[model samples]
Structure formats: structure tokens, C-alpha cells
Target: MSAALRPFDVAAIRAEFPILQQQLEGKPLVYLDNAATTQKPMAVIQAITDYYSQCNANVHRGAHQLADEATRRFELSRDKVASFIQAYDRCEVIWTSGTTEAINIVANGIAQRLKPGDEVLVTEMEHHANLVTWQQACLRSGASLKIVPIHDNGALDTEAFAALLSANTRLVALPHVSNALGTVNPIQDLTRLAKAHGALVLIDGAQGIAHGGVNVREIGCDFYAFSGHKVFGPTGVGVLWGKAEVLQDWPVWQTGGEMIAQVTYHSATWGELPNRLEAGTPNIAGVIGLAAAIDWLTQFDVSAIQAHERALLAYATTLATDFEGIQLVGTAADKIGVFSFVLQGSHPADVGFLLDKQGIAIRTGSHCAQPLMQRLGLPGTARASFSVYNTLEEVDALFRALKKTQRMLA
Candidate 1:
């Protein structure tokens, strides 16, 4: 089907992922752990295989035929990432290990310029990746780290966010979507607010990248970071899209390999925007596979996929509402299909264990937002995150299994 013409067919979509067509024990596998890492489709697998089997070589430094092919595909992947996020320029796309490394690059660079009294604002909803990096940066620079509050329902407190901003607020780091709560923050509005306060904004786009169309220029953030694996691409590869003007003269994050322009025993000049930040050999196959994943994703109508996911969330929510012995976590008005809850009188880990007996895979525990869990007064939560390929039948199966789990626990 044409990119514009293909309608979302869940059966067809599920068929593309070989892992989904499996049985764990005697029960059919119902994978609901998408928020951790998406299953790779054949397209991504084939792309990686083609790269290794046909043209595997070091990029950008050789005159051989294999090197030329490798470099072409590797750089084209950069263009794909730039176009995917609507970046200002392809050079603005810097490859990193993943979102953690991407944010580290920014945090480390900013640490060089931060002053003692400078303040950094981050939300309570941040994954530790966004939180810890900035926290350590503040520690290194003697800057103060301020946290923006979230409501009991897990929605970001916009009013409190505004109140926290000040002339001394040097940066505002926020998650585009809360990994634990599935709360989708109003990034564009929040970005505008930070810009008015003259603070640079960085969006941790790990969860938001695949859910909706992302336009970095439209959002007006100084930097946006996302992982390839979160969007059904390869792990160990990610993109850091920053405004060219902001990144062009920024302090270099790494100092070796192609990032250097001139070398001496004592002094070396750094290269331009992207290469200046990307040091050493990159995950070439992972990048190519990520591009292929992007190509595969764009083939389906994004709106249809979104609609399907919404229906799944709504149906699951309805079932959760009527289902006894369950208390929902992170009931934000705006959220993705991450159904997090705890059965009454049972630990989240226990619920997850019982669900797994029925072949339902869910993520249990704090989900890397320990502070958010503390704020919400939960030891942890059982999370069933969704994706475009998930089906309503699978959701039904989840609840059915949950009922059995609750009974077993009771």
C-alpha cells in the first residue's frame, strides 16, 4: 500500500512483527511492555542485515567502495532523522547512544557555562534520565535545581511551572511525555513560557516521538532528544536535534575522532555542529535500521494509528473502571495508552507476576521515576503501555487475565 493510502489493519500490522506470533508456555503471548522497547519489524531487521552483509565498513574516513556505501547510508539516516522531527537543518541531528547520552551532551555542555546562582527547572514527571543529568550538572556548577510540581492526577502544574521560572532560571528540562504516568505535557506552551523567561528549554522526547507528529521548530525548544528503540527502531542509537544557531558554537561534548578539526600534542580545535558532539565510531547498523523503521512507520496513516490507540486506551480505561480490586494510577486527562494500576491488597510486582502466568507481559515497579512514585504515594505500579500495533482483543485478554490474577491474589 502507498504511504498515504494504507489504512491501519491491526492484523496486518501484527503480522509484520515475528515476535508477536509466539506462545509463551501454553498461552499466546500478549506483549504490553511497549513503553520499555518496541518490537522490531522485519523492515528494521532487513535493513540491519543488508548493511552488515553488503556494505559494512567504517564511515567517512575511507576511499573504498564499501566505505562510500556505508557513509552514504549513515549520512542519509541523519537526513531522515532531521526530516522526521522537522529540524531546521540536517547538521542539527547529532547521533548518540540514546536519549540518556543525548541529554548528557546538552547537560554537560551547559554545565560549562552555568554559574553558581543559576537555576534549572525540571518537572516531577521526568524519567531519571532527564532528572539525574540536570541534577549532576547543577551539582558540578553550583547551580540550584528546582522541580516543577505535578497535580495528584499526574498532569504538570502549568501555573506552578510559570511561578518557578525566573531571570536566574537558566534551563527548563521536561519530558515530552511522562514515561511513568503517560502524561503528555503541553511542551509547545511550556517552551514558549520558558523562552519568555529567557531560559533554554530541552524536551526529553523519548515517549512523544512515536505517538504524534513532532515539529521541533513549531515547538520552539532549544533541544529535543529521543531514542530510536522507543519508536521501534534499533537500540544504542538516538538523535539529538537542536537548533543550529544554538548548537553551532556550543561547547563540544566529546573531544576525539571526527569531532576534531585540528590536532596537536597539546591543543586541538573542534569541528562543526554535529561532528563536534559525536565522537568515536557510531552505531552505523543501528542508524540505518532506525531509518528503515521510520520508513516503515510512515507507510501507515498516522491519524488512523492514533485513533486505534485511542480506542484501545478508552476501552481499557472503561474496563479498568468497572473492574473491581483495581485502582488506576496516573489518571491524567491527557495521557497515552499506559494503563498503570494496582490491585487492592496486592503489590504491583505480585500483580505482574500473576498476569505473566497468563502470558501477559507488563512492566512492574517504579518505572524509573522513583521520586514521582514517592510523590504519588505508590510503592510502584503495574504498567501496560500500548503502541500502534496493539489490539483491542489483546486489551480484553489483559483484563481477563487481570481478573484471574486478582482472584488468585485474593
Candidate 2:
């Protein structure tokens, strides 16, 4: 690896993100809304543009030249995703509209096999995307949805999680990291506990994939889902990985043109693991853009990226904690460069609006983790999440903006 591949070259990395260079409200855009969606790089943008320009065709349905090119690119994107997560085979990778769709696919597929009186386990820290799908699935299947509560520090109670696992537990869906609190959970440990109880495991990796790279096989998880937008790709693409045998046993959730092997009024057969799950026409250009994003990420050492983000997290946390009346939510030993905090007597939305005038974009709300917010006894939190393209200067800018907000409110 080159020396520039080392962590903390914020200047060089920021240059690749053209949007960050532009002004918002007459100031440079200090993008800290990474938890919502990351800013795309030139490579990803170009990939999407080039695909639509040259390879626009329906995938897996035609024999024309454009279709062939589009199909090749689309399938190649699946391969790239499989490699990105170190899955056993590309067949294990299924593309969806985004993480919400991916989780819904798992919930629906597993719901088909569930019986009344069964249970599905989850935690209070889950994003609504992970929570509601299982909740609805259990309701439809006549199975119960069991939740493991969190401690005051916003960490999952592992012992409580263990207690929730039982012979009747059909599945355990949990987040690898909390989107609201940046709490990194012990996914492997949870998977082991669920497996020991003879239950399947699914991990929601939306925030986890943004901070650290994952290998689904290494995690020993039955299923893993994440969105491309969280990992610097386009918004429309996401991935769901399952064990080949597990997916092979799943009934098709949707039916349409490309996923069918053969069809009749009385009988229809679906394709293999991935195609069976991915019904209808796939998102060709978005998938191609995701592949390019993965390629761009692979060019630099991931270890260096993790290290850089950790350093930034430490600095940012220290700065934020120094301010009075600012309460930090999650205090996990392991966390991504995400911080959610609340200033005394100030609503998160107010803080967010004040910061926006300075061109510091952040997320302020329940962050789709309403259960977590309820557990913490707050309405919501102001969240500043970092990406590799963010710099120390941007972190300083955030502090300055927060101080200005504080002064104005006081």
C-alpha cells in the first residue's frame, strides 16, 4: 500500500468527494449526516452515469447487446458484493431496494415457515427498519416478538438477550451497531446464543458496515443486510446475504419476470438462491454504482480507514464531552465515529436548525430507533456521524457551531 493509504489523509480523501467541496449557505458543506446517508464519491457518481449512458437495458430477460452488457454488470456487482463481505458464494448475495427491503425479505421468507406460538427475538436498540418487519412478521405468523432491553449506557444487556433465547425462538434479528447510539453489539456472541437455542440469526449491518468492513462467514450469521447509501454508494441498492442452504429453502417473497425458471397457471419454479429472492427487474445502474464504490473502497486499505475513523471519533468525542449540559448517549467500548448527544433544555431539532445555518449538516431526530429513544427517556438526539472523507477541521467546525447554538439559546 502507498503511504497515502495510511489513515488521517483527510485532505486527499475529501478531494475525491466533489459535493463536499461545494458551498451550502455560503459556507463549505461540513457533512456529518453519514448515518442517514453518506456523500458519494466521483467514482460512484461516474459509475452510475456511465452505466445509464452505455448499458441501459433490462437485466436477465433479453439476448440483445445492451441487455448482455447490463446483465454482465449487474451480476458482476453481485460478485463484488459477495467478495466485499467474504460470503461463501455470489449466489448468497441478493440485491434489494435498500436495507429496509432486505430485512423485510428475510422477515417475510422466515414468516412463511413460522408457526403460531413461536417467538422472534430482537433488542430495543434496533432501527425501526429492523424492528417493525419482525414485529409484523411475528404478528402475521401468530408468533410473539420478544425484546431484550438496554442498559442506561445504551448497550444491550447480553445476559437479558441470553434469557430471551429459547427453544420456541424461531429467529433473532439484531443490529450489528445501533444507528442512533453507535453502540456496537457482539453479533457473533448473539449468533452463538441463538444457534445454541436452535434459532436462526439475522444481523442488520446498516451502521456496522459504514464503520468497519464485515465478512458474513466470519460473523457466522445466517443472514446479513446493509444499504449501499450507508457505505458511500447510491441510495437504491442494498445487499442481503444468507447461507446457500438457508436461502435455497426459503420461499420466494415476490414473483415477476426475471426470477422465474418456468411458469404456468398451476405451477411455477423460481431461480437459485439470489434470483429466487430478487424477483422482478433489478436496479441495474445502482448495482453497478455499488460495485464501483466497493472497488474504490478496496483500493485503499480498510484497516487504515478504520484506524482513521477511530482517531477522529476519539477527538470528536472529547470535544463534545467538554461542553457543559451535553449528555452523551452511548458509551460502548467499541463504537463507530458516531456521536448522539443532547444539550440541556434544548430540543434536537432546534440544535440541528442552528447548525444548518453554518453549513454543518447533521441528523436530529429519533433516527428510526424510537425504542432506543424511549429507553433513554428522551424525545430524540442530535447525531453527528463521520466518514473517511470528513476531516478534523470539520469536527472543529461542528464544535464551533454547537457553541454558537448554545450561546444563541442561552
Candidate 3:
């Protein structure tokens, strides 16, 4: 919590986003599906429009005036991203399509070092994107994947994570925050344990970064990945931050026009860290929009935002606690602003549909985390995730809607 900020005013903050003012079915929208993707503000939208309309040109290749302006804006975005995460160097950052692609980049690029008997350790709580890529990587390189178990409360069993690290462990990958459960892992300690076994660490910040700040050098993880859409930015752009040295050593996963240094008919050299990773014209508008989103987000007081979310989460939990047959899926000590729960007799999809009729938006089903759903011994749960834009009034509306839903089923 920063000292300069005062207590958050939800009403004041809500005014900035015009989309939230709209109605569905003659009712005001109550958007509770933030974990799926946050709604973008006018700032982010305007940033994209401004870039294409004014400074429309290619970057890094042209010597002309418009090209130089485009290049400057693009590089400014890079610096903004680097500062947002507190990266050691701006060059450590590389852009990708989204979290899935970022994770895949590491999985595929690191394949050159993996061989039979080498292990890539993960956990049971991982999203399929994280799980499947490593599964394929292990299959290709003859490396094996290991899963660390979670406690019944949905928190990572850190003791179990420590116990799983062996001499053959080459990589340990985990999420900073679980998209399904909202569990915030102790990544610092996890990284330390992995480092003790001479294993590199990759922390998936897809669900974590948008809600809170991240310091890459402080966390000391080898790699961190997150998506733009999750953070009020455009959908197509994502970030993969690595220690510059580690990124330099990883084999190039993609190759094309922009990534090349010299070309013969036979062999060619590649560009530097980011340029080598980015192989084409890139998502120009998406990147610019993301930069605008980051800039807009940075303007608010983070402490106030955190306090508001915590209060709203507490309120939501109180309402949910009274439902007799309902079961809260994840009760981890450290959770973000997400709630996943199931009524004993109700299917998640049915609840989702009913809520939509009330002009309430929430996500239901596996949430790209089918394994986690199976672990909880359920088909799925309806999840309501909050952001800075959500209000106590919206939370009350959700509770009223849920009570209505429970009665209709009864």
C-alpha cells in the first residue's frame, strides 16, 4: 500500500469505463466475469485508434520520418512494460500472442537442453495451456513431467513441492496465481527451492499481474509470462520476461524475415533476444493498445485498488457462506478477487444461463482448468471474479440473483 493514495471510491472509478454503464435486457450490467477477460477502458481503446490514425508506419526498419515516430512509440511501450514489472533491463522483455504462446515459447525453446531423464516439474493446479505444452515438450525431448499435489484447501503444498525436486529436475513451472482457484503461490520460496536443485523456474503471471504489481528481479524467477487482455489491454499481445542471459541462451523457437541478421542460401545468423523471438511484423496495434492500458493503469493508486478488492471479496464470501448446500471450491489463505462455488444440486452451466438473464455476467465450467475441477470432485463451478471497476452494489446484486436462482431450483 502506497502512502500517497487515499481509500478507493468505487463510484468515482466506475465513471471512467463507459461500457459498464450499459444495460442488458433492460437491466444494468453486472460484470463479474473479470477472470475470463477484463473490459477495456476508453483510454486503451483511444490509444489503439490514435496509433493507427496518426503514427501509422512500420517500426525498426525504416529511416523515414513516420517510420522513426512509429519506432519511437513502439520502443516507448517496451520501456513502459519493463518498468511495470521492474525488470532488470528493458531488453529482457519479449512479446507474444498471449500467455499460452509465452509458455509455449519457453517449453519449445528450452527443448534444445532437455534430454531423456531430465524432468520438468509442475503442479496439479496448472491450466491446460501450461500442462499440455510441457507434456508435448517432454514427449519430444524424452524429458519427464512431475506434478506436485495441492492441499484440500486448494493451496499449493509447498512441503510437497520441496520434496519433489530431485537432481534431474531441469525446470520447475508454476502459476503465480491460479486462474480457477485464485490461490496465490509463494513463488519466491518456490523459486529458491528449485534453484537449490539447479533447476530453472518459470512463473505464469497470467492471473496475477493485472491485480497486483510484479518485480521480476526481486522474485528472482528465470521467466514470467502474462496476457494483455487480462489486464485491460488488447487481446492479442502478451509479455514473456526472462533474465536476459537465459533468453539469450534459449534456442530460437520461430524464424522469419525480421529475426534474421544475414542470409545466404545455406545458413543465417539470428538477431538479439527480443528480435530473435519476434519473427514477423508483429501485433502492432495490440502492442500499442497494451502500452496505453499499462499507462492508464499505472495512474491509479494500487493500494486503494487492493483495499477495495479485498473488501468486496470479503463481502462476497459473507453472502456465500449462508447457502446451506453450496460449497466453496477454493478456500486458500491467500486468494485474489475470485470466487468459485457450486450448489449441491445445480449444474454450473444452468446457473450461468440464469445469471445472464438477470444481466449478471460470470464464467462457468472448467476455465481451462479441467484437472483442477476433477480434483475438487465436481463437473464445474460458477466463478465471479472482480476488478477495480466492480462495486459493492454489484456484489449485492449478485447475491440477490443467487438467492433467486437457489429458490427457483428448489
Please report the candidate that would top lDDT against the real structure.
Answer: 1
Assess each prediction's global lDDT (C-alpha) against the native. Answer: 0.91, 0.88, 0.88
Q: TM-scores across all candidates?
A: 0.98, 0.97, 0.97
Q: Looking at candidate 2, what is the lDDT of residue 395?
A: 90
**Highest-TM-score candidate:** 1
Q: Model 2, range 1-410, lDDT digits (tens) per residue?
A: 57765444678778989899899999999999999999888999999998889989998878899989989999999999999999999999999988899898888888888889899999999899999899889888899999999888888999999988889999999999888988889998889889999999999998888775798887888999999999889999999888998899787879987688899999998887778888877888889998998887877777878888887788888896678889888878877778899989899999999999999999999999887788889999999998898888889999998999999988
lDDT for each residue of candidate 1 in 304-389, tens digit (9 for 90 to 100): 76777778888999998889888888888888868888888999999999889899999999999999999989999999999988
lDDT accuracy of residue 283 in candidate 1:
96
- Residue 135, candidate 2: Cα error in Å is 1.1
At residue 353, what lDDT does model 3 achieve?
90
RMSD, one per candidate, in order: 1.2, 1.6, 1.4
Ranking according to TM-score, highest score first: 1, 3, 2
Q: lDDT at 393 for candidate 1?
A: 91
For candidate 3, the lDDT comes to 0.88
